[model samples]
Target: MTEMRYTTLGRTGLDVSRLCLGCMNFGSEQPWMMNDRDASVDLVHEALDAGINFLDTANVYSTGESEEIVGEAVASANRDDLVLATKVYGDMREAPNGGGLSRKHIIDQCEASLDRLGVDYVDLYQLHRWDENTPIEETLAALSYLVESGRVRYIGASTMSAYRLTKALYTSDVEDCSRFVCIQPEYSAVARHEEENMLHVAEGEGLGVIPWSPLAGGFLTGKYEREADPADGTRGAASESVRSYFTDENWAVLDAIRTVADEEDATPAQVALAWLLHQETVTAPIIGPKTSEQLDDDLGALDVSLTEEQVLRIAAPKQPRYPES
Candidate 1:
């Protein structure tokens, strides 16, 4: 390998590989666009062989298909050389008690995640999103219980509002529970929403920031035309979280990114990923691939470096899509 890099997850006592394999693609068959178990297996092995120690998936991913594949892969490796993480909090069932930070839900899902992954414990278990109805204490308490029970090695949170994340960290310290060791936010060259505040808060609190969709919902993948075809494929549909950013204005950023990609003789995907790696607070970028070729293109990011001038050239000026415009 190219002397693959590594970094420590702030205060989590977990040293994670700089490049984390995202298994969200392994989740659903209806989302027939993503990688299936067999295809994902090949890509995961490619990452493992490349010295990637961090693998991120979520219970809600493909309704837990992602976790199943990641779990199976980890077990097959049997080296304990990788740090595995997955999330909970999206509705996994039709019942009222199906999801959220409810003590019952968190605990129930953690065990189910473990079962699906075929592992006794998860390296890091995260709340996929915040639940306003439930007190942060209740959520942290349940997460603490898991760590204390040895079912989870560490805990993190994803998609929490800035205020809620800060509140959770403080609550964990005051209540003597497992705090969020990390925060998963949507960030990338085109998605700079987290930079507004979450990035600073995470860096200050000693919590690692793992950015999901660092590729900007396949916009950074070098495909899709802003004018020619507007309907995003299934991959873009999964990014309902960022549906608002898919606008004509954001296309300007894509155009500039493409220019830089051409200048470097690299794929836009490689340039996009390289953009995120330039940030120090970015512990790792969650990258999902549906094919070995796509996975290889993502890995090529490790080799491409952008100059300071180049980084500034495409830096999103304001909101990707103006709030008013």
Candidate 2:
């Protein structure tokens, strides 16, 4: 395996691996989940052995089972050596106060997440989404309290409009509350929408950009051809979320990716990840691998270097439209 590279997360002093291990598949919430505790633990160990010190999970993932699995995996490893991150803002229960970014929900979920992860303090605590129902001030104040109380070291946000993120940052500055240090946006070769707004915001603010679904739910892996149905056992066979990428525009993107992958003598997955790795604004791209073999292939992205022209070829299908300020 190639030597893992590390970078300081955004402008912070905290160092994290270039590829964050995503723990969303560690639990059995979905049919596509690995759903094997021993295998999930082994996968975590594999990542750790490969020099990945960053792990990203969510409290709502498998209703906290993913965190529990992660906690179990790290029990044998040194906690101080890893940068653990998880999210909030998903409905955990059916009743009221079940979820949202309100002060009560934020405080309550932080405790529950800490317990599930078996950690006193999480390295990064992110709001899974923007809760329009709650005031940004209330959410930031609660997150700031967590930081002051030492329950969370840093706060982040995910999957929100650029305006909302900017507002949150402004509110934090004015209220003297903990601000978001990073963003977890859905960015990949097939999904370039964030490049228009969120990426620009994160770059301008010096915030870390750790993108989720960097492979577009495996669409960029080149497993599905243009005129054929997805094979059984593949995500596309059962997941509408994965099939959603099967548009004409995305197929062109995949074609460009395929050409680049052939030139690099690498797998489509590695090339897809390499594209993200080459972006100046991206701090890390979360890799969700269900098995050790997949993880090994993903780790190979560090060694796959792309020329300037090759990068443009892969990105030519979708050009980002920057909004005039």
Candidate 3:
């Protein structure tokens, strides 16, 4: 295993691993997810052994089964040494009060997630998505209460627009509530939309920027061929979201990534991950691997260093195109 690297999470004092272990595939409640209890637990152990101390999960991931699996897997490890994070705002139950960032739901879900994870407090409690229905103040206040009550150490946001994120940060500052320490956005070699303003805001505000789906749902891994369809049981074949990424533009980006991988003698997935790791603004990129082998490949990213020219080459094709020819 390569030497695991650690960095400060945003401007906070907490030090998180450069690669966050995403437990999205830990439970089998979702048909598309393939990991069973034992396999998922084994992956967690492998990640820990490999020196990863940060784990990310969501309450709605496999209907909370992922948290249970993670809880059981990390039961033997010292909790204080690890950075455990989970999200709220996803509907765990179908009831109106079962979801959203409202104070009721945030408090209820944080307790429930704590119970499922077998931990008293999560290092980072995130809003899975922005809930427009609830006032920003209400959400910030509820999260602040979590921090004050000792159920959550820090707060974060995921998958929100620049405007909403700025507004939320402003509200937190004005209300004297807990400010978001980090932001999780869907960013990858093929998906560079967040580079426009979200990344800038995160840099300006000193918020850690952790990107999920850094492989573009497996497209950047060089698994999908140009003419052939994605293999069965893969994310691309199973998820419509993944299918949408199979466009000519993304394919070109993949080619660039492949070239860089070949030059570096690394896998395309590793090269893709390296692109994110090399960014000054990125604290970490969430890596969700169904098997330990995939985890190992992801960890290889820590060793794959891209030069400034190589990084630009990989990203050149992703530059936005306005009206033209």
Candidate 4:
């Protein structure tokens, strides 16, 4: 197997795989999840065998079963060779202090995640979402403690407004805390909203940009038809949330992507991921495949290069929108 390429995650000296394996679908607790423990373990092994050293998971995925599966999957591998990551700020329990970016929750969840993953430290401990109730300083302070304590090497934020991300970064600087080295956002041909300011902010701030849902929750795979209903077992058919992505404008975007995919003699999924890989600001786009075949197809994106005209054509009409000052 050809080894996947590696890249530096933002300004950090750590090198991570260009294709990060996301373990969201690794466990069966969630109704939409398709992988069981053994299958999840096999996928992780295959990913590592393919030279994908970066792995992303969250505490809330399958209520921590995902982490357990990941833990067993990578237990025998040399820990020092991988860049392990997991997120906090999700409700892991029903208690009042169950979630959010509060100091207590951040610290508590970090330990719990460490326990679940059976690892001493995570390379990147991300704030899954912005916590409005918690002060930025408080969250940063707690995360700083984790870094100082050697429980987390680096920190990242996901899915926050550009303004909010700016504030958090500024507060980390002023407070003399460990700043976020990366940002994970939803970015794809159909979800170009992050390009408006988030991508620019990441570029200017020297933050690594790792995008999730690079295929727009499987919508860019050209599986869902414009007139017909989503097929059974697909993400679009299983969840109303995924169905929301099948908008008229997104269908047009998919049409354009399909045209380009045909011209390039590649699958729409590969072309969609290649679009993200071609981005100068993107460090990597996380690929969460339900099966080994899917993982192989996603990795094929590395070979699908697009011309400048093709890139522009794929992104035409839907310009990034910026907020007014």
- What does candidate 1's lDDT look like per residue over 219-319, in tens digits? 77766765444354555555564456666667777777899999999899989888888987888888877777877788788888899988887785546
What order do you get sorting by lDDT, best first? Answer: 2, 3, 4, 1
Worst 10 residues of 4 by lDDT: 316-325
Quote each prediction's TM-score. 0.91, 0.98, 0.97, 0.97
Using lDDT, give the best candidate's number: 2
| Residue pairs in collision within model 4 | none
lDDT per residue as tens, model 4, 287-313: 989888999999999888899998988
A best-first ranking of the candidates according to their TM-score comes to: 2, 3, 4, 1
Model 3: how far residue 131 lies from native, Å:
1.0
1-325, model 3: which lDDT tens digit per residue?
Answer: 5999999999999999999999898878756575589988989999999999999999999999999999999999999899999999988887779788899999999999999999999999999998989998999999999999999999999988788899999999889999999999988887887888578789999999889999887888888887898787787788898988878888888889899999999999999999999989999999988877899999999999899999998888777421111
Which residue runs does candidate 4 get wrong by more than 4 Å? 322-325
Better of 1 and 3 by TM-score: 3
- Higher-TM-score candidate among 2 and 3? 2
Model 2 / residue 174 / CA error / Å: 0.6
lDDT scores in order: 0.80, 0.93, 0.90, 0.90
* lDDT, candidate 1, at 252: 71
State the TM-score for model 4: 0.97
Q: Could you tell me how far off, in angstroms, the CA of residue 283 lies in candidate 4 after the best superposition?
A: 0.6
